[model samples]
Target chain A: MRILIIEDDQVLAAGLKVGLGLAGMTVDLVGSCAQAGEALATTAFDAVVLDLMLPDGSGLDVLRGMRQRKDRTPVLLLTALDEVADRVKGLDLGADDYCGKPFDLDELAARVRAIGRRGGGRAAPCLTAAGIALEPSTLSATLNGQPLALSRREFAVLALLMEHPGAIRSKGEIEDRLYGWGEEVESNAVEVHVHHLRAKLGREKIETVRGLGYRVQVAP
Target chain B: MSSLRRRLFAILVAATGIIWLCGILWIFVGAKAELEHVLDTRLQEAARMVDSLVAQNGPAFAAAASAAATPERYQRQLSCQIWSLDGRLLARSGSAPDVSLSDHAAGFSDRRIQGEYWRVYTIDNPAKGVRVLIGDRLGQRDQLAVDLVKGLSIPAILMLPLLGGLLWLSLGRGLRPLLAMAVELKAREADDMRPLQTQHAPAELLPLAAALNNLFAKVETARRHERDVTAFAAHELRTPLAGLKTHAQIAMAAGDPGVRQEALRHILLSVDRATRLVRQLLTLAKLESGLAAGQSERVCVGDLIEEIGAAAQPSGKDVAVRIDPALRDFTLTANRDSLAIALRNLHENALQHSPEGGAVVWNVTPDGRGIGVEDEGPGMPPEEISQATQRFFRGKRQTPTGCGLGLAIVEAVLREMGGRLVLENREGGQGLRAIAVLPPATSPCP
Candidate 1:
């Protein structure tokens, strides 16, 4: 998952980007409402972690604008506003979740993962296919109740495929979420990550469309 | 007489003394003349009786007069003499001198006898061809007048001390309420703002008591506001403290250098937030602490907006400065520093809510007297607009990083300048539009 962080405080935004990056998700940051709007316009983010107060304007200005354009990317509001009514307003404004500032980074990562798991119009945090069960929050998978360890990239590829069991995701779309700015990508990076995922969870669980991309199939 | 009781006592005693003295002097003047008239009548009757006795029994009266001795009290006051038609000194009283006492002008005469002033009366006996004279000293009538005045005034002089004591006591009783008020005021604690009791107070002192009560009420209100600000300050500080703790814990627990570096960055951010909060809190307290009131100076509105643009540029350099055409030369009467503070707050508020590339608009309102700021940020609901200016009121989930005193400082400054702050949603739900209205200057509108 690649998440965009809209925060005015440069230090905090940098810290959040690093913390979420180490959790195997690519993170992008913008310090003002204008930058956030521009970034959102050009990129398709899996989720957005928004700060309500920004240098140029409130992050809500960005949020409202995104909603007006029918951009339904999941949003998790990360602000210093902790009141119940404040959370309600954010939720009513189409935010998927609300988290107040001084929050735990681990908890924030989990929530973002939770949003990605529930993507593709599904509501579960765990996906099961071909006798392989995956928990996106823990980044762990089980084959017939047997535990298996996967590298960060391998886990990311599997989570994406598990999230959309029937849809084919192109290699370019997967590359966009797998790496962020300044991160070098190889020609076979997606193929390499998928090869490891298939070795651990059985190659039949994922189907490759010639000249297209990959998808996870439902169990027989 | 500085004391209420003493002043009343002095006035009463002095008035009584003057009136009594005037009445005594009036009676003494009128009675003195009437007394002299009666003494003169007695002198004339005595002279006629002696003249008749000498004429009716001339040899016998002379022999009886020679034998009679004058009483001591009457000796200096009276004397009698008889004269014959041939001018013979025929008979005289023992008190009379051997020389003739008067020329005997007939009814009354003044004469000098032995260096003493004398009043003399004379009677003529035509049948016997003789005249009689009686003379008394001028000093005698003066003595009588002195004796009569003393008799009337002695009692008044003796009663003066008693009257003074009574006046002092009554005046003290009349002024007791003021004394009670003084004692109550003196005994009160320094912070006490309770009203002075008005019951049992004199009608003259009720207004004073009521005014003191009003003062106490105002002081109490000020003290209460200070307390609320202090309490709010304590609560708001916890946000920075909580942030600091979160970052410190992360830095300590993390093993990766990248993770530690990230936590350190957060720690610095938390410190900055705390510092800003402290600075804002101090500014707001100073404004609400009465340093923000009563400074009327001529401030050009255009220049003032420019100053705000410069001071707040650090917050948002992209804030587009706008001045209504009519406001380019507009000037208003206000304290430059206070108005500058209000304008800065308004600008920061707009900057914090406006979108990227959105202009923080500045202008003179349609009326040309009010200075205004507008933005294209996400606007708030109508219900929360009224509460935005209250102290320590950070907005809901939309609450930003701030001390929450920005709008409050703006309000205090505007109100102290005899102006008001009006906040409304920007047209079409853009953002907030805030105005601070002050008295316009003498300069003509552009």
Candidate 2:
């Protein structure tokens, strides 16, 4: 899942970036509402972790702006204001979830994954396409009931393709999902990851159309 | 006497009882004098009647006067006597004493007859050569005066208890508002800061009620301020703690030694930031507690600056700190601890805002009333200058790591030491200048 964190605290923001990245999510960070709005306008994210307090303005303004623009990316509010009223106000403002500050890293990651999964229109925790299954929670995969080892990038590429079977995802979209802002993208990194994914899942499992993109084949 | 009702009731009842007693005494004295006069007049009338009868009916009538009856109303009260001009006793009534009532020829006199006091009136008929006397006992006149006094006083004495009861009840009715106010206050919850009702209060208690309500309002404002500070402190502490926990988790999970080292460094940074925030909060709390400046001492500005500079230099920002030579040996009488806190906050604020290799300059004000700290950083907007000293008030140029308590603590400490903080943009328009203005009465130590 690709996630964006909007927080003013640099140390906490950095820590969250590192922590969530290790949890198998591509995490991006913006420190203010203005930066967050710019990032959201440019790139599509699976989920948003928003801090209510920001140096520029409240995080709710960002959420309100996003919802007003008909953007439905899932948002998880993180704040030090643990009052019931604060929580209710945040949730009523189109927030998908709320987490108070000083929270456990594992729990935050799970909630992010849950909201991200819901945004993709999936009810199950695992993604299955063309006889290969991927468990996003554990970042592990299986082909025809046999466990298969995959690198994090390879797994991310396969998961994007398999989210909706037979749906074509362009190279730019896959690269956007694999990397966040300021993360360097090497030449043809997506093509390399896709090439490795096909080798593990069988070449017929993923199809590349002429001058378009790649997609996971649907089971017959 | 402390109770208003008791005091008023006592005063009223005592005044009324004293007046009643005075009235009874006046009646007793006045009645005694008037009774004596009336009895004397009756004696004279009786004496004249006997004399006239002696003259009209001659000696035979006079001889029958001893058996003749006195007026029915005065039958036992009056006594009469008749005697010839030769000083011999002529006739005496049955109730009269047998001795001569008086030796005077023809006037009223008081005489003791047969060891009994009498008020007598004498009439002499010159043509007939006889004297007639009528007398009344003085003791009986005194008894009538006593009866008059007893009649007036018995009712007054009996009415005292009833008067006291009425006074007590009336006083209670008059003071009902005070009691109601007490009950209202007593029944209030400790956190209830609502004002006391004053609109319908009695005129006498209006000032007291208004004062108590004012006190309640002030307490409520103070309590609200305390709650806000607590909330802001909790909010400030959470961010650093969250960073610490997240970084610790990163340090534990990372497989690469470089990432682990980076995570450990972040953990240390988080701990330091948290420690600084906690210390700042404690200093702010202590200043807010209204502790008066304690034990003034002579502090050299040069030494104080040097000490803070040494402690703060570890940040390694490469900023140049220049202190005015005029303030090097200058000494001032102040509370050393609080003064240090104020100066330290100002110094930290200056260093934090200065650019790399920039200058932080310290100088005493030209007028000698205060000291100034200048930083080569973004000065605050003119509109935000007034609000800069408020707790948690971060300016538009606020850095992400700032907790916003620095200026607030400086202002509080300066205020406690009878001083103030004045913030302004530098004249050159490149940096900010903060001045801690000491009390006007303070003078540099010689």
Candidate 3:
């Protein structure tokens, strides 16, 4: 799992990235909203850890811009303001979760994971399908008691699909989930990934809905 | 000297001195005028008497005048001088020196004889055609006037000081009540806000006393409210903070991951409880101080309840909310933040007291005035109901997780909004029913 942290407090951001990296997730830290936007445009992250107060502008504006562009990448808002109005405003603006400052590092990690899992469309913390177990934090996927070697994109696609087991995700939502703010996308990018995933796994591992989207059905 | 009595006495003394001075001036002026008029009249009377004697005795009048001119044998307080027609000094009173009255024709004249002012009258008798002049010394007239003034002024001057002293004493006596009030005030502590005793106060100060009492009543109430809020905050935060510290320490010391996780969970729960307590404490303080009264907004009861239910569900309690369909869209003018705090506290209290997995129902009904939250938990004892509203007052049946400030916060909000909180047992004797009744909104939309 790739996580992006947008926080002005370099010390706290560094501490969080180190802690989360120790938990086996790749982490990238950005100190301002501009840097966050630039990073998002360039890289693909599983989740974005956004701080409400940024050096350039508010993290809410970034979140709102992301949502407006149909980017449903999980976003967790971190803030020092513990007022209820601020909480409501953050959540109402589509932040998956919020944690106030002076928070325990463990709690922040837990909340981030929770929002990440939810935004990935997974209901449970652990993802399992067809005797395959994938741990998002470890970014490791195993099939039939054997681990599979997969590229970053393949792993991301598998994770997104397995997160929502039966839910039909539109092509656009899948594209949004797969890409960050301004990543370039080929016309048949999802199709190419689906074909490749089929070639790697079983033919029926992933199903595509014509003119709508894709769904990862439960194995019968 | 700062006392009102002393001040009033001083004022009265000054006024009396002024009036006494004016009276003395008036008496002095009147005595001087009266003396001058009397001296002139006496001189004219003496001249008339001498002229009649001269006419009766003819040429022998001069000799007779000399015999009658004795100042020591006068009928009234008068002195006389007589001169012949040729302006020669003839007969003179012993008080008068040998000097001609005047060379002028017979009339009345004022002359300085021997450096003394004298009123002299000269009479021309038509029968004798002799200018008979009779003069009386003005000194005698002025002496009489001075004597009269002395008789009047001596007693008046002496009484002025006596009158001033009496005025000073009376003014001091009249202002004793004010002095007593000052003494009482000076003796009290700065923090003392008790009402002043109205006994012995003057009628003029009654309104001032009443205003002071009113101010004291308000101040006392405000002070009591502040104390209650502080005590509640301290009491409520103590246990949860201690628990948080303990759990954090345990988690830090634990070697096993499972033990550490469990300790972390406990720490989190403690932290959550502490946060809730702090929020409630702030809400209670705001409500008690009436700080939120001016910031009231229109809040929809249904939406508010839904939000509270969502927040309450995280406690893992079986919390249910049932809004009367008839009252679904009802709105009220209240401080939304404070109202939310109050409703959340009630929900928390219910969740705590209800058996695990037991239903904690939040029923919102339109009590003629406003919305009411009726909880179903183990209701408090009848005697403890009133005490529960007080800060830091915990009932025997209260849950260990509670900070005993839930009902107190509710009470404070209700009071700040000019509302009331009623606690009673549920109909089935199942649990407590806490109702927060607010004033009816001026307008309601269904």
lDDT of 3 by residue, B187-257 (tens): 99989998999976889888888888999899999897776555444434443543454456546654568
Listed per model in order, the count of residue pairs whose N, CA or C atoms clash below 3 Å is 1, 0, 1
Better of 1 and 3 by lDDT: 1
Give one digit per residue, the lDDT tens place, for model 2 in B265-352: 9999888887777787788888888664578888898789878887884555889999998777668888788888889889988998
Each candidate's fnat, listed in order, reads 0.12, 0.77, 0.00
Q: Write the per-residue lDDT of candidate 1 for residues A1-220, one digit (tens) a residue.
A: 8999887555566666766776778898887777888888888999998987654456777889889999989999876657687789888888888777667877888888777655557777777777778787666778889988987787778777777676798999898888876789999999988888888777888889889899887855
RMSD to truth, every model: 16.4, 7.2, 22.7
Name the regions of candidate 3 deviating beyond 4 angstroms.
Answer: A1-220, B1-12, B29-230, B241-272, B282-299, B314-321, B332-339, B346-369, B374-400, B407-446
TM-score of 1: 0.49
- Name the DockQ score for candidate 2: 0.53
User: Which CAPRI tier for candidate 3?
Assistant: incorrect
Could you estimate the TM-score for every candidate? 0.49, 0.66, 0.42
Model 2: residues >4 Å from true position, as ranges? B1-231, B288-294, B382-387
Give the CA lDDT, 0 to 100, for residue B110 in model 1. 80
Better of 1 and 2 by lDDT: 2
TM-score of the candidate numbered 2? 0.66
**CAPRI band for model 1:** incorrect
Tens digits of lDDT, candidate 1, B1-446: 27767777777888999998898888888887897688788787677667666766865656434333235554546777677767888777766776666776688888887786777888777787777777766777777777778887898888899888878887778788888899999999999899888887889999999999999999998897775555445435654654566567668756788778878877887788788877777777777797656566777777777776776646534556565655568776667787788888887788877676778777777766677888888776787677677776555424446667888888888777667899898888778788887644432345
Clashing pairs in 3: B377-B431
